[model samples]
Target: MRLRIVVLFFVLAVGFVLAPRAAAQSPIVVVSQSLDMRFPRSMRFNIETKSNTRITVLRLTVWQNGVAVGARYSPAFAPSQHVRAGYNWSFQSLSEGGYLPPGTRGEYTWHIEDDAGNVHDTPRAAYAVEDRLHTWQTLSNDVVRVSWYEGDAAFGAAIFARALSAREFLAKQLNIQDIRPLQIFVYASKQDFFTALPPFSAEWTGGRMFPEYGVIMINFAPENSDWGMRATSHELSHAILHSKIRGTLGDLSVPHWLDEGLAVYNETSDHAPDDQFERMFQLAVLRNTLIPLRKLEQRFPADSEQAQLSYGESYSVVKFMIEKYGAEKFAALLNIYEKGAAPDDGLRQVYGMNQDELENAWRDEIGARSREISTARLPTLAPRPTFEVSSPLASPTVLPTASPAPTAEPTRIAQAANPAPDTAVPAPAPALPASGLCGGVVMLSGLVALSALKRRGGRDSER
Candidate 1:
């Protein structure tokens, strides 16, 4: 009985240690779908394993329209660290027609087997084929064509399309027609994207017009977030502004302030106050720092603190101009610039005012508005004393009112009242003693000696 009890205890201990290992080695299956996945195009599916066991072979089977279209077994693959393995299965279009027929939809099953003969099958996954043409469409007028990718393509196309639309609207608003078309490229993944167009390292970049191809490359990879609406608008603004004015005006050479301001003005969205221009203006106003319009085009501080201020001031100045002078005048200025005229000259020609005068007007307008705001926000103060008081005098005697004593003169009473002036005479200027002179010389000699010693020490160290 004692031997049997010991044997039972040994068995229990072994099971306790091996149970977790067995569990950890068990197979696990997980599935995920892309946020922008659409039908009829190549969609990627990832199959993974959770066990440490190496998967020598795996098989994937896909079904569409109640029929198996793809059924293939993968060759042996080594299990990766973290005991997880992944396979990306892509479905291509069935025919060269580029459109999948209607009523074509079905599920897919992935069968995975590990080298240890552990079998795992995925829960049935489904997909449908739809008409590609109807899914993606673009609208074009006589001058420019605007199309977008909708199925599994990058979101940059939608952004670019919106930007073009905004440019067209603004151009018409400004009556500056003859806008040029911008061809936008949309990539599915960052890897595929950078493979085509090299990466850009700048924070915010513009003016990528290639003289050889007459095409501008405005990369949106860095700004490819859901919150990148303003960035998209900003880039598109550059494209439109250049296309419209550069050809006619011979390079427009507009100041950075005006350029950035116009871009920001066009970039405003209706969603939130955190949009580019508003945020910048509010920050500049709060921080009491604004970039002057004349110096806005040149390099200002690019630090986060200063950039925020710069953007705010630029937006405010542009908003002030538009609100005070009207959009027609602004548009006229653009037209003049497009005709190869200097900004100052263009302002004078179009608005009957030079650049300096316009800038001054804008500044004065902002100052007045700021003053009004300050006055409105001023704190209320307590009222002043109301009544005068009478003197507490008893008898009404005609006493002479002593004239106020003359302001007293400062006196050095501590020095002497009547002591001998000669004796008190400030001691003769202390004669420079020989010891003092010798002491000065000795100090100088010590400094010279220290300097020499330092020089010798430095030379010795060098040697």
Candidate 2:
């Protein structure tokens, strides 16, 4: 009896240790799962499963390649032993919030639950978002892959070469040691390029860079490869710089001046002068009307002329800093920003000065005096203007102030002349803990919105 008791206790201990494995097993079996890539329109997810019990719940989860959190959808299906589930995810909704750029990759999976309490999960499948309308030729090296449909292999080769050179120049300048792989998709015409972008993209947009996905799309003809090369270098610089600063908490708030400054300055691998921006910068200096660097910390002016001046000043100041302070210090400053330091705080920590001081220093270096501060009396500071009694006989009627017009949407300004129809909204999908180059909400809210600043493609093909 003692021996039997000891054996029974040992059996119970082994069974307890294996209980989780046993519970994890389910009678449901996934027969097959697949994704149909429709490109620029919609992709359908289809799954078939069999179970001894009626399948009560079928859920589908989808996410971009680098992102951790996925959006979950419950595909409607009747409870039965054999279940088929499918959902057609429309790209039309992308115009409202998010986008899946051409060449972007993603994954999907299916979850099954049955009335008998059995559960099963289909293995994850991968899909690449592409432009199915065209047949693209691709050429790649370790750094970047160039794809083009209009040009020959040589056309793709030229862009690939320029991209490699640009990567080299930026890595050396910024002390970037490791670079993530990048994809460049060349669209031969403006219409083709616009097709790849979300519906509401600006009409003037010539090129766009989706840094989170390491993708750049540009519209330039084969004969204009020169401009294409420069644009490639400019956009590639943005991607590499963003990669350096983006962290688990999402991208740090690197000042707009610094971000665009570095990109415009690096347009040429040899550091050739940008004559247009340089001329504008000189004009600003001569007029003593230079924009305060502090003002440029958030955004540049909207007016085209003022925007040009802003860009020129930014390039000049960035160039001056690098030439005077050395690349190591500039790189150190970027590292500080990556750790979440504010613009002034990062500059102060790295160089012991703030935006105003830095702007003054750059001004002095460029033979310009410090920016003047106006001391004019404000309308509020002035005593209320004496009112004449001429209206006393007729009682003056004070008109109400007019409200300001609504500003254009932040970046992707769809042309009003060609408006897309409203799309059917999908049911709210469950969200997972967000993690990626862009965080959960920002990621789905069109991570490519960063390209807005580069949308105008200033001057020639400068995007």
Candidate 3:
């Protein structure tokens, strides 16, 4: 009996030791921060905890718009705790995926929890966001100003030179002069570039451009001049193309297919006859899922698979237009849009063909199904080509756009555009992708194609 009593006592003692301890008394936390979103400037947080009670939770919540995103850390007290949490609107955003790019408004707050079951919330703080990148090192010309970190000054100049060459090419093709003061931001490292994006940005996105500010953000990995120059050229085409259309029409109302097509067309690749885009496009054609020009002109599929088809269709059709019809006639088509001519009217006037006629011609040349997609009959922003599906040549008021001469050494053609379904933008989506384009699945290995089409109907609306 005595042994049993002793055993019971021992068990009780062990249980007592194993039980969770009662909460410690709370500590008093007084926190402050000197947040400056500028380079050659400081960005961090300072917290002062003055209490015997232990801290359980300490975190900084970076608020963008009203949404919160941040990191938690181990708590420290007294002797003036310093947290090196800096704020740079040019780089960090916590609100929405891209709650705030530079030149936007946002707020942030801190939270603390103590062992005493006590919680603390800091007052909301505001940031005067600006284009802090402007303060970075710069290389400029009459048309563009290239911004870069000190380490990438020479690279910045190189891209600037390449951009000028691209500008000449785009202007000649679009038949428009460059007037905008373009600025390209060259991130020395992908990490730096990624850090500056909204949380929702996709991994595939390598660069972005905003026509509003004439801003372009591209990454340069030390010595990869080939990619840097190519990317620079690709983005420059967007700026030039949009500015030209807007200049001509007094509004940037160009269609996505046309806009993206023109951009991809300007891509100069070492592998001149790659067939990736062609195979993907052909697959779509064989599947009988080719998006009719009507559906493609207004908006593209939000699904990647469906979206790839649209990109492929756009690139293919545009390539066909340029090669089949003379570049001058194509320029005239753009001029029609500039004059506020409807797409159908523009086709009829320029090529003496309606939308249907053009669609049929493209389908036949590519050996795609001569039949029209049935889903295309569903509601779309604009009407499909007027030519009947039964006959591709139903309404040719003018001669066929195809060439009669033997094809000059046939080259392979292929590519598809982005199909981001979840990303949302706050600004009017640029009628297309900003060049937010970075997060898109532009899958072609070397083509600066499929820029993430942030269909944010606002701010960055698609073309």
Candidate 4:
């Protein structure tokens, strides 16, 4: 009987010791997780978890909102049974190559692991990295969305209508029907405009495009509707053209001339050249100071006059190609570039001539002398150039002028434009797995192309 009692007591002691161990082995439970998006500064992610054992690892995985892959971060936190982990994502001092644009929608998840080896993954949450300082209203169509904080509904509508027109025009011109959706954020003032862009942005930046993000930003009020429309169309052209040429394997390095030329040409709905741009081209032709198209294959010169002249020359060259060779052949040229053909190589395949020959052809058509060809060639992988298209303050008949009065809207303008959409809808922020341009899918490879436009004052625009 005594031996039986002793065995019972021993068994009870063993049960008491193992009970806690078994409880510790239970699965970890996430109590709560949230993201606080604070614009112009940082985003904060906080998560709380409960577990029987000490929480040893707390990881946060994030990617641009529609992207499949992302980077993982292990936040510093003390080990504890019930723990709260927080991480602050900063907006300051972004690397020139790996910066996220404002209005970038993102997704995040928490990876929690405990000392007992139990793991728990919280459901993914979505957030927008946007300017939260002001209230914003938006308008969207099937292909595009326009967001604004300062403008009235009419202002937003006008921008949205113009964006749609540009989209339709470019789609027809490029023979691209299945275009991804795009977002445009128009800031009413210059201070607000520069606030949204990267710190490295130049002072002359009037508008900017983040193609990988499907985003375009510009600073224009209702009174400057003509420039606003032109700038909007210009950036939209870049975004659309990029979508057509950005390949599954990698982005084809498009020649700066072709890229900016197409953008300037598309500033007007009818694809008419800007008068100021034409004048700049004519002036350069007379002075024999026209920068060779080969040199422009990589980037334009930094001098303000040279930059203006570069845009003018590019516009003239692209106009010549389309009017002479036909739009179908131009579309075919883009296809060749998408297949990874070199700049001159693609031109030759499409036009039966190389860069020099094409330049001579364009020159002859324009009544200008042929440019001298130098043997010097820029590196195959030249530093990505910033393209800046100039938006002269010329009002075209194609786009209606906005009401100069701060409070009143013209009956014609309001009637023609659509109202704001139901919500500030986000477009697909897809990142290529090959390059870390859109989001850091593999590594921080940054965007292959970051283009900007000069305001009316000729601030050195870098596209």
Q: Considering every candidate listed, which one attains the maximal lDDT?
A: 2
| Candidate 4: tens digits of C-alpha lDDT, residues 56-133 | 988776666423335455677899998988877766533211346676766677777788877776766777777777
Predicted candidate 1 versus true structure: per-residue lDDT over 1-463, tens digit per residue: 9999999999999999999988765464443322123433434445555544665445444443311123333423565422333334322322211222222344555555566666666656665443243333444433333333333334544555566555554554555443433433332233332232212312222212221111222323323433234544554565556544543113434555676666666654431223333555665555655555555554345344455456556666667776777776777666556555665666677678654566666767766232212223334222222111111111212222332121121111122112221122212221111111111001121222322233223211100
Evaluate model 4: give its TM-score: 0.74
What TM-score should be assigned to candidate 3?
0.52
TM-score of 2: 0.75
Name the 10 consecutive residues with the lowest summed lDDT in model 3: 387-396
Per-residue alpha-carbon lDDT of candidate 2 for residues 6-98, written as tens digits (9 for 90 to 100)? 999999999998998887789899888877877677778899999998998887767664343455667778889998889887665632214
In model 1, the Cα lDDT at residue 36 comes to 22
How many clashes does the backbone of model 4 have?
A: 5
- For every candidate in turn, the CA RMSD to the true structure comes to 37.5, 16.0, 21.1, 13.7
User: 1 or 3: which has the higher TM-score?
Assistant: 3
In candidate 2, clashing pairs total 0
What's the true lDDT of residue 151 in model 3? 58
Q: Which stretches of candidate 1 lie over 4 Å from their true place?
A: 1-161, 187-193, 198-226, 248-250, 269-277, 367-463
Sort the candidates on TM-score, descending order: 2, 4, 3, 1
Worst 10 residues of 4 by lDDT: 439-448
Instruction: Using lDDT, rank the candidates from best to worst.
Output: 2, 4, 3, 1
Question: Largest TM-score belongs to which candidate?
Answer: 2
TM per prediction: 0.42, 0.75, 0.52, 0.74
Clashing pairs in 2: none
lDDT, candidate 2, equals 0.65
